[model samples]
Target: MSLVVTPLELPERWDEPGPRGDAFRAFHAHAERSNAMRFGPDVVARSPEERLASLQPSLAEACRAFVAHRDGQLVGALKVYTPLLESTDVAEIVISAEPDLPDAEVLDLVEELTTHGEQVAAGLGRGDFRGGSLAAASGAVTAATGFGGVDPDHPEVAPLVARGYVLEQVYRISMVDLAALPDLDERLAAARAGAPGYDVVAWAGETPAPHRAGMCRLKEQMAADAPGGGVLFEPEVWDDARLADFEASAASGGRTIRTVAAVEGATGELVGFTSAFVGTSTVVNQQDTVVAGAHRGHGLGALMKLANLAELREHHPNHTRVVTWNAEENRPMLAVNEATGFVTVVHDGVWKRRSVS
Candidate 1:
């Protein structure tokens, strides 16, 4: 059967009862199945309602989605996120298909999705493209960063390689069971004591007024300081407006934001911070954790993380596990995570296509 590709008509409310709502739900279900096949059975995809709630757009980025059908059955999807910040020249695209399809069918679906995604991006004046996917670590195709590799034979990976996308970096997806860590309190105490010059502070929901500017600065620094390997990303620009938009968007999506920060005791400035998203599901996502360049070596990263995990426990007690991704080359952050009970579950390959111009 011939494949039909079309732009997904996003609903004003994802729950509106109609053909659009049905398509929305089916697309998410297909996404979940694709993730399970690409990663492993242990990996969990976001629930449809949870995914819909979090589909937020902001001044910094605009999001779009497309669905593929064959014989009126939803078979594949493509999403594009165009950055409106300093990296406006590039956009990120994600494409997925229903699992267990024949190899030929899968390739055709992926190829069409890629061609469509590029056309949409180019129309928006985006020349560079970024994407990520999970792949088994069994092939000779190594990331340029020299830290991780992915099987080129993997169904999800081969199409990208064939289309000239280069593997830039590999991210290790780690998970930690909240209930399994019996010594969290002790670890928090040690991390706090080690950072004598810094004090820990935390909050649930929106950023407090006094810390908004400082948080913005830390966010900007996070984009600049985090290890990107060969991926091209200009530092993000965050201001009061952007922060407010972020909080509102998260709230609209039914996600509660929990944050912990390290304050320099002498200056009372927020030099480092970490945040987690507690959504409608049981999983807690460990978001950005960064310490300013001058504030490194004080164990601030670990300190903030431990404090945030404690906050998650106290406020959102029903969480099953904390999940985070880090560049495989980032040994310091990985060390902190492993010591705190996180184990590597899978690896994600970050791929990029240089400007087509």
Candidate 2:
């Protein structure tokens, strides 16, 4: 059967009630289970509404989704999003085929969706694409050499690799139990003592003006500072307006972000910081954590993380656990997380495609 792909009518069908809505929900559910089959049970597919929430346009990116059907039955999907924070010539794309689709057909669907994603990005005046990706959890390839040979068994992996994409990083999803934490006070005390001449402070909802400037500085440095795993993150262009938009959009999505920042007592400049955000949902996401280059090696990373966790314990008391993802090669940051009782729970692949012209 020949498959047809077109822009999905999200605004109309998203909140629509009835059989059509049921079909819409069923379409995504099938795609999710299908993708999970490739990765494993750890995929933990997000609910349709949660996926919609992720698609909400941000200050730096715009999103679009498409449905692929053959004879009117959903067969696959394409998600295209471009990031202004990254280079103007780059976009992120994800394509999925129904789990039951034959391997050969999966390749065709991926190629078609990729071409569609490229067209979408080109329409935005962008070219190259840098998409975060996933693959089967084992030894299909090594990190430094890009994607190696593909097992004919896993044809779904070929499209991106065949399109000039490379595996830049491996991120492992990790979680820590708040209820079984080793000891809050002892760790917090040690963190404070380890980093002298700095004070740790916490915030919720919005960043206050005094700390806003410093916090923005650390945030702006985020992409460049972290280990890129051979991929350029393309430093985000940050400003007061951009930060405001981020906080507002997040709150509108039912998320509440809590942050803990370490301030230099003498200069009052933010030296390091960590943030955790939770929605009406149970899981609390441990967000960006960074220490100014000048402030590293003082155990501040641990300090801010512990301080933030302590704050969450008080505020989001009912939250069961905290989750985060870190590059597999980032030993320092990963060390801090593990020291705080975080353990690797899942693995993911990060891939990117460069422009030919």
Candidate 3:
């Protein structure tokens, strides 16, 4: 098969009439196909407008896209993201191809896309290229955290391994049936009674100006405290401007960010927070949940999640499920999620390859 790879020239608008518009639609289609193959046919995919809006660069990262074609038809797409806030040495690459193709053809596309990814990373002065793929937990290759494994024969895994990428970590991807949640009212009451001097507050979209800095600090702390296993994730730098950029970008993509945070009653500072990103689909993505080290063990994590779920149900009644990813070793967060109604569906492997200097 003669496959041609070309950089995708992003159009100024999603509805623009041209070859770029066609490529944009094809890129989203490839992603949807890949998602269905990896997660199942029921997976909710980003709409074309949402996908285009998501490509907008933010203060944290900039993305570049590429497309692969065979016989003038798109067969694969690649996205490379370079972090601007922190972890500047790393480039995150996501590549996917048509699922109907044979393994050999799939690997060929993978190889070609990975080479393009590496070249992009080199041009950006990045030394580490990182990628992740979702797979069943029962497999021969175990994660560093000892909780999940990926079958070596999995299409996504084989290509990365063949390309010399080491499995750094595995994240448990869980789905929460909002309707089937464990007596959250009881759980919330118990969690609140167990913890004193903290009040849980919920908000949608932009963060209140007073809590913005606290939210930034909490985000930075989350980046520092989260389990990394072998993946070298640097502590992210977050400020008011960066936070605004995040909210703006999400709003542009038609995503509503619902946040539930625990505030110190005396100091009026945010101590822990949980966020849910809701799009037009029925699925809501649980983005981040973290508690400050000093405030740990007070049941703030569960309280925030319970409050967030309440907010989600009250405001976004159309959404039926919530999905989240947690490091296999993140027992605290995992426990909170499991107790709330989340069950593991699959495990995602984080693979990294460092350039040889």
Candidate 4:
């Protein structure tokens, strides 16, 4: 049977009251499930209603969806977001009828989207389509189109390499598993015994305000620690107001953001930190985990992680899994994961394609 792909009608179909709503909801549910299995539970814990509502505006304005139909049955779909951003060309989310579909079909779908993306960019007078997190199967399209690999340590890129995509840069995805929470008292006692004169604290919502400045400094430090000289894509700086906004976003999505910080007793300087959030639907996602350069050898990373894990176990006991990612080459962060018992699950790759005109 022949396959046909076409653009999805927006607001009209998306906001409608009946069959369209059912289809849209089903599609989003499918997308969420795929994301959970492919990217892990932390990344996607939204209900179909929540996802559709959150994505409606973007999908209505700058987003496009392509549906692949084989024998009149919808087999695959891809959603691309084209916000007028500085660095990324397109942000994408995908779902497929055949989760284990052959690599060739996945490549074909990606190529088709790339072609569509190029035309969209040209129409807007932009000359490139910069995308990230190309799955293993889709890496073929990315490679074929000259999308340079970036961040080899990126959690998604290894599978792409196995399928022949080139390695570019290494970025780490740091994670902790709630299922394996260690004894907090023993972990903290060990860290304090080893480091001496260091204290750790957990904060959220308004409580994070006191440490906003310290967190912002850590945010700036991230660029230096990032492999490939990581770029801060968002405009908002890490400050009290921004932290509040993040907390709000998490709360609205039914998630809790827990930020843990390690501070020196004498100097009161922030040395290490980690953030974890539990979704309303019972998934825990780790955000950023960092330790200042001066305090590296003291095992503060593991301490901060253990503190966060303890808080999650006590406060959000319903959470089933704790999910996070790190660049493949980030040994230090990976060391913390090893100490905390986070097993490697999924590997993904980042791909880029520039316009040839």
Candidate 5:
């Protein structure tokens, strides 16, 4: 199979009022439709008007869009960032061909893009170009691209592994569902029967002023417990402004954040907490759920999860299904998810690469 790859200037291809601009939008729509499991329906549901409004600013700044054509037909496309402030050089490549595309043709397309990426990085005085979600079928492309492995859990890791990339870091993705969640009242009653002194309240995002200090401490403790966790981030990490940004982002995407906390009646210390985000797609992305070490074995985790699901159902009545991802090794958190009615629908591994030369 023969293919032609071309570099597209963002302004020329994606700017307002251009033929190439329309093509770019159509390309993304096709990609999202073909890869629904990866990109999700929210992206597929984006109208052309919405796409233009949402992507115009980013295109003006760091967009590098490319398209692959075979015999005058568009076959594949990629989008890469051009060294922004928050990112050195992050890139994502999407292929629209049928899954049956030959390995050789795919590798050829990857090599073409990698060559362009190297040129772009060098011109910007950067040493590496990072790509995410390389997929299991793109092993040859990863090897040909010369990107070293950074993390195995990243979506791109499996392909990198097939090409000899080493693991750098591993992070866990945890999740829960709302539809099958246990009855919160039943769990609360059971907890009350066992430990009548503790007060369990659903966090309505209106965390009480008195419990703020305890919540801060719990946040710090959870961060500290992160496996291979790095230097402690400042309080600003969980400050009101940052939390508000999170809330706003979720709201914009038609998702709701629910948290439930268990507090000690005597000292008002926060002992356990669980948080869930209900997305427009009905997938409940479990953000963080933890019980402080001092409060383990009290069934507080289940109580919080149950409460969050109940509140989510109240707010978002249209949601029918939810999904979450967790590391295969998180026994405690996995136990809570299992008890609360979340089952694994898909298992994905993440991969990363750094300092590709």
Candidate 6:
């Protein structure tokens, strides 16, 4: 069958629901299924409306998405995004294929998509870009630099290596079963004894006006504090405007973000925090957890994580598991996760290439 490649016509059918837009829904379903394979379903969990919102242009990233069709069926998709935050010289691309596609056809489609991605990157004043493709293992997404070389194990790694990409980072994927979660009472108590000056604060949805300023600062701390593992990164700066934009986007996508934070009783400042997101999906996704440097050794990180997880479980008892990813070098956070019942399920690699376009 001949394959046709074109820009995804979002406005033409994205809003059509149910019987009215079978084609649009078909593409969306394909994307969701493909994402479930690349990242765990819980990690990429999103309704079609939420997924659609993600594909739309954002102030932080302008995306150009494309789909490949064969025999009137959507077989593959490629999304290229140029970050407005940092890495102006770089772009990020995600490519996926229908599970049943022949290897040759998948390669052809990906090659075409990569070519298009490079064009977009060039238009954005970037000399090179990165692309992430599903590797051979489950829950393993491999990234390549310069639109090419990536994790050695991914099926597409060879092509990328030939194109000058090389492995840069490995991130371990971990999961915790909520049913078997051990008692955190002992840990929480010990942590609280040492951090008696700090109290836990819990919230659902947007932060309260009183805590908004502190939450913003804590988010920035999370970015600055997390281990980068050698990829180009710019610390994401956050403020009321950005946080509101984030909440609005999450709402539009049918998501609820729940957070737990440790506040300094004396200053009313958020010193550490953890976030978990649940939407229409059964699996909860653990996002950022960070403690300000000044509050590090006091066990506030573990306290914040434990408090949030308990609060989350109480509200969403049906959520079977929680999933999170950590860079291999982030031993402290990994230790906290391991102690809390998280087990490594898969490993993902991030790769980089330069001036390949």
Ten-residue segment with the worst summed lDDT in candidate 4? Answer: 137-146
Over all chains combined, what TM-score does candidate 1 have? 0.94
Q: Cα lDDT for residue 110, model 2? A: 79
Candidate 3 residue lDDT tens string, 302-322: 888887877877898888788
What shift in Å separates residue 75 of candidate 1 from its native position after superposition? 1.2
lDDT (Cα, 0-100) at 244 in candidate 5: 48
Q: Which candidate is the best by TM-score?
A: 3
Candidate 6, residues 33-67, lDDT tens digits: the string is 87677666656567777767777766567777777
Off by over 4 Å in 3: 41-44
Global Cα lDDT for candidate 2: 0.74
**Using Cα atoms with residue i matched to residue i, what is each candidate's TM-score against the true structure?**
0.94, 0.85, 0.95, 0.74, 0.63, 0.87
Instruction: Rank the models by TM-score, top first.
Output: 3, 1, 6, 2, 4, 5
Deviation from native of the Cα of residue 222 in model 4, angstroms:
2.6
**Cα RMSD for candidates in order:** 1.8, 3.4, 1.6, 5.9, 7.1, 3.9
Write down the RMSD of candidate 1 (Cα, Å). 1.8
Model 3 error, position 188 (Å): 2.3
Error of 4 at 126 (Å): 4.9
If ranked by lDDT, best first, what sequence of candidates would result?
3, 1, 2, 6, 4, 5
Model 5 lDDT at residue 234: 24
**Highest lDDT, which number?**
3
Q: How big is the positional error of residue 225 in model 2, measured in Å on the Cα after superposition?
A: 0.6
> Which parts of model 2 are misplaced by more than 4 Å?
12-14, 18-50, 96-108, 135-140, 145-153
Taken over the whole model, the C-alpha lDDT of each candidate is 0.82, 0.74, 0.84, 0.59, 0.53, 0.73
Q: Give one digit per residue, the lDDT tens place, for model 5 in 1-357.
A: 567666643333334667667676656665556456454554224444433333433311355556677787666666655534334543333334424456566565555555555565566655433443433312333322232213334423434455543332222333444445446567656656676557777755545677666676676666556332111122222455444444454444234567778888797788877666554455555666678898877777766766666666777666544555544445677787788777544333333344456
